[model samples]
Target: MRKRKWSSALLAASAIIAAAGCGSDDPGTVSGSEVYDTCTTSIADNVPAFYKTYFRCVTITMSGDTVVIKTDGLPPHNTYYYGSGHDKYVAFDFSKGSDYHPNPNTLKQQNVTIQIPAAPKARGLTINAAAVDAKVNSSSNEYGLGPRGVALDGVSLFNPLAAPGDDIEDEKYTFDPYNAHPTNNGAYHYHTTSKGPLELLKKLGKTTNTTPGQAEIEVYGMMCDGTLLLGCKELDGSAPAAGLDSQNGHVHDIKDKAGTVHFTGRYHTHVCTSIGSHKYTPEIQYYDTCK
Candidate 1:
């Protein structure tokens, strides 16, 4: 996003932490001891949607000049919605060039311990993670009539349960925009977007840096029966759907002042026929209060 300069006061504070050997050029090389020396480590007091059904914890350990972080949890599902529901869980590969795929093994478990060689000193770093959980059934109303081929065919579009044309957005369904399909007769679901990681890092009080592998992590969420157990769309300041709560969803770039970080949540609707429609309701029983 937009470049941010650390305030003099913040710079001074960061300097103190960096001078103590907490700062390094390489994030992957940071040692556990170094983190303990310069940084105050604390875990998220409350669990987010990623851990609602599954137990998860983030551990930051520092030794001398190293920072070690471990995330332990499991992905809610193996395969989710691609662009269209027509495709099943393909294989997991960033190079595959497909919108949908199987959950990366990197995000499968809650326990991910990373040993960085060094932590950046000039800029702060952020790490993000999430997960989803849902029971899959083939005969349930949650499954759609099959993937909506390309255009908005007779099959349900956004939500299979909707009466059609209820919340159709001309821009979203057009060929230029590339319409999305229903998944497994359940609501449409997809992979984690930039928003998740950004939010995770901001919650940890670290700004994101573009340095290679400086600030990054695999984030995952799941959908079931045409409903989002976790995650939400990027709000445009407009009022949300009726009965849907705004606080339940995630806000993109919570720390960015200029909105430089461009991240949008995935849309998963019409995978199920009885779920009604997609309303961008993300579940967040617990979240870190922004400072």
Candidate 2:
């Protein structure tokens, strides 16, 4: 990712949100040797093929049992959020919906670190109180004004929560075509369904002629606490099985391209609004901890 100076306004906004940071350091600065010392295989070298196919402009590596992902939080598509002079800038297309309105903030690069377990488990674990307060509220499942996960296009994933006295459903009016909007600090994030990741998948030929009814199992990204986020279907193109918990998560064997099982019986959440009732990314942390 490119390095850029953090604007003073952004720095002030960063003080209010936890996911804010300067894009000065390159995520790719650490060499292979420096990233995984004494561990012959680098994390990026061993990550499942799906990650390589989905994630772009980011660095992935293993730090012991955890996978360390460093991203410069910026979407790869055109949006009015990119502002007028930017090359990727595109005026917001108001034809999609009448409620479409642009937020005042513009897109700014962010340095974000996501750490997830290489092999996540169900364990039926409860999030610690401290982590809960830092990330979200335990009762309402409202996101704590920070990143809960990361999207394939290197954008952050926030839970379905709005600021005090504001409801996310009401805030949806401000979203761009991709169902994303930046915070006052310029932290662009997804609270619900994101067309950006789906568009990336389609462009990569990972999906073809997909519809809401016949949706395929698509990987979006992973949460900081080791939970994997998926669309409406499983990797095998089947609907998610029943018995998903409040977080829209369950333990199951994840399959690969050849129909071979990987991450056997691991915990994952489905944010597939097309196929399931849970339309937003994980609002509650099913795992015990997150960094």
Candidate 3:
């Protein structure tokens, strides 16, 4: 009888060990060179599954109600910003336009870690609330400049607003082929519609379109307050429903082209330049809690 009990206990221990090992071995797709390595698949089970499955070029972990994301903040694609010596570097295309000129800053790896609520709440009543903290202020839904969120390619997403006295419309011409540029400190980020996120979807076999506004389905990234950055169409490759706010945003379920539902009643904004007057990243934060 003692031998039988020992056998059962040993089996239980083995099962526990297997379960722990399974978390990191979750079919990760590690892509990229030494410049920017992307490890998207081998993530802990505690992290939200959507981020684990769809996102690339970052390492994700969860701590209680907060989701912690760590990335080098270097885009996994070719850019003139990567500098000439790097493998990912490309010569700037002078043919893009007469107004389009490369910014002086160069791209480099960044140690960026952002913490956000795993399950964010919408600010229905707090829409008009007073400000307290800039990171999670209620009154000020305005996104502060610099590193608002992470893009699909592990790049940073800045708000639509440019620096003080600098015109954002003018800055759009400074973006590279992927529609992104670096800050004065060398932090590369996306400010408007880009082929970066759409290209990732195509690489993952999720879609065939890679164009910015013309893609079949385009999704940029998640903001601190759980706002989804979408393109011309919804995730299912259909037209965005009517009644989008002035910011070209609305609350709805976020699903993929394959009919997999990722979030329910989520706030998402469209940044498609082809469809409407709004043609840049979202300015106002829709959800209540950011941290």
List the candidates' TM-scores in order: 0.21, 0.75, 0.80
Q: Per-residue lDDT tens digits of candidate 3, residues 180-273?
A: 9999899999987788877777655556789887777888888777788888999888998776666677888888654768888888888875
Angstrom error at residue 56, model 1: 9.9
Off by over 4 Å in 1: 1-57, 73-107, 119-193, 199-291
Count of backbone collisions within predicted model 2: 1
User: What are the RMSD figures for all models against the true structure?
Assistant: 20.3, 11.9, 10.1
Which 10-residue span in candidate 1 carries the lowest summed lDDT? Answer: 148-157
Ordered from best to worst lDDT, the candidate numbers read 3, 2, 1
Kindly list the per-residue Cα lDDT of model 1 for residues 25-46, writing each as its tens digit: 2221222222221122232223
lDDT of 2 by residue, 1-291 (tens): 223232445334534342333332323222332211111112266665545545655678778887777777888778889899998889887886887788899989888888877666444555343333323344543334588778876789887767767777778888887888999988898886676666655544456533422445477777877777887777766778987765567778877544857567777877765544666776666665566
Candidate 3 lands at a TM-score of 0.80
